[model samples]
Target chain A: MTEKSAQRRPGGRTARNRENVLRATAEVLLHEGYEHLTVARVAAAAQVAETTVYRRWPSKAHLAADALSELARTDNPIPDTGTLEGDLRALLGQILALIERPEVRRVILTVVSLATDDDEVVAAKVAFWESRFVGAAAIVIRAVERGELAPESDPYELIEDLVAPTYFRLLVTGRPLDDRLVDRSVELALSRQGICAAPVPGRPASPSADD
Target chain B: MTEKSAQRRPGGRTARNRENVLRATAEVLLHEGYEHLTVARVAAAAQVAETTVYRRWPSKAHLAADALSELARTDNPIPDTGTLEGDLRALLGQILALIERPEVRRVILTVVSLATDDDEVVAAKVAFWESRFVGAAAIVIRAVERGELAPESDPYELIEDLVAPTYFRLLVTGRPLDDRLVDRSVELALSRQGICAAPVPGRPASPSADD
Candidate 1:
């Protein structure tokens, strides 16, 4: 049976070909924003037929999204440091490093802005986040269980507060994201009892006590 | 000469004309996103000649920034309710109202995104913030005086934390900038210090200590 048709192919040639195409797509995204990214260019760079490229991904935007999604997943490793502040520092630090790569930040900003107007791009972004959110949430939930965060707080918003400032300044204000800022953000959020410090609802202890 | 030449002739008419043009520009911005805005459109809406608009503001981006600067100046009111919590509530509440106005929010995002590429736009944004930051700082300083915040803390970053999340979510996530979210933001910031009743640094007292 052809590798492409097989439901469970023991992959060698087909999978390597796919990886090469994705790597080429990522290179294009790094060099050009989403608008200029072309499937033909990717096909040429990947040494594959345009038909083969089209058979796997119908659009350049989808190809670019997939490439970036793959990069984001692998490059930024989420650390489970057993504390909310430590975890945020680790995760946001990775994000900062990712942004530090020139043109990557611009590409991500362009992708996000385009996503605002395109449903397919938005779905791609959501899918990317969906792949990571569960892992990120595990870190937060562990922090809560360990009394590093206030038990009553919503982990999502708490994470948002810690990292959103950096993203806002980086993407909107054209500012560089840095580690000092990340540490400050973690301190600021954790000090508020909203991360791992919020007391569990209906299980509040003495005023100075933890849940 | 005419009023135009009179303003150009080093007199008060320049300020009045600028104000009138700025007001008209703000009206347009409040109605349309920055992408859809134009200098000619602003001039028509302001009842000013196209040359007159060009004579002062060089481009649509400049006109939009100037309009926002004027708006920021006019609404520089942050209520001093003698508590950090109340102060933040009022301060954030004002921002919430502004973001809820779709036209203003759209213009803000457009201009902010443009700032990434345009030096002139970035300068205009910086200048606008220079004026507004003073007002925002005044509120934070007052909170320090009233024993509502950490006396030695950096007011700028604190304000950044308080405001960045909502703007981030609004512009990036396209979420509804609702009051509940605003309230939670204020609460999170305040819970860190005695925005409600923490005494000054040298003095010792936690008003909520009884709880």
Candidate 2:
């Protein structure tokens, strides 16, 4: 087997090294800011050889991008709960929890700050958002199949409507987040599909259970 | 008369000095960023004495706060179009125009970045948003008076819904802003008030005109 394939084997030294390096990268980016982040610093913090980090991730931009993407992936997993409301609540719950962390808030604000001037960061930011939208698309697709959403509904717009208020409150307005915001967001998004949260007369109490 | 009263006179030298210093403070914050902004640098840029700037705004944070607040006030004026839809469209249009400027975007991102670490900046941000909400409260109050909305509708929530998506797209999703998004935002917020943009059959087409 090739050396690269061998290194990439599950639970191998390379896997451990990657996790350490990404964790160090995030720590440095969060505490020290982006300008202070370097491959050498990350490698030293991770207790790995500098050459190893360079060989695996050629640039600081790539390192930062991967670190953020990893954080997003691990912190938020797509929920497959039966009802769209349940799925939305679950997904938003994960997002709210993730962003509430001091480190996560710093990372998000820092990336957005850098993205204003750095092309690499801009690309990374766009890719990060695209991955999130793609992952959440399944929730929309499932709702459409279940007749909770119209077949012609755009998943991206629906998701945007659902999460924009939360992010806006957090990042722009600096307002507090509470259960009311979460419930209001879900209600607004579902309302767009003409799917009321309250049960109507003569309708199945739980549509997913009947299906 | 008190010495402070003399400085407060309209079109006086003190007024010109205040204008110059504020403009210079914004220039430094926008171009050099928050970390680089100082009373000395602003005084130099404004062609005023350092003591003059220090006397009025004692701290960099105070200067930064005033500069941002000044930017927000001059760039956007609350619209009084005599209709909720017209007012929302006008207000959002101004916001879109302002944020699309590179300098304005930098100022906004910079303040948010600094607010995370600085107590004064946090207070400043809160005050900035409060002023904006208070300014726009007139729109909602007028709409209610015209029977266009429920009397109990929360004005803050209505304004939040109207502007959150735009800020979210700009700062979080990094998406392009267009007329469609603006229209959709206005529609969604108005829909919450049960106000339809399209006229129904056998109704006064222009409700504002009828009033």
CA error at residue A179 for candidate 1, angstroms? 4.6
Q: Please list all clashing residue pairs in model 2, or write none if there are none.
A: none
| TM (chain A), candidate 2 | 0.76
CA lDDT of B120 in candidate 1? Answer: 73
Scored against the true structure, residue A34 in model 1 reaches a CA lDDT of: 67
Summing lDDT over every window of 10 consecutive residues in candidate 2 chain A, give the lowest-scoring window: A195-204
lDDT of 2 by residue, A41-101 (tens): 9999999999999887767877888787787788798899999999999999899998888
- Top candidate on DockQ is 2
User: Candidate 1: deviation at residue B155, Å?
Assistant: 3.4
The digit string of per-residue lDDT tens for model 2 on B1-211 reads 3547766664567788889999998888787778788788889889989998888775787788788778878889899998999998899999999988887888778776665666766676777788888888899899889988888888788888788889888887778898767766776666655565553234322211222
Q: What docking grade does candidate 2 earn?
A: acceptable
Report iRMS values in order.
Answer: 7.7, 9.4
Instruction: Quote the chain B TM-score of every prediction.
Output: 0.73, 0.82
Off by over 4 Å in 2: A1-33, A41-58, A195-211, B4-14, B44-58, B196-211
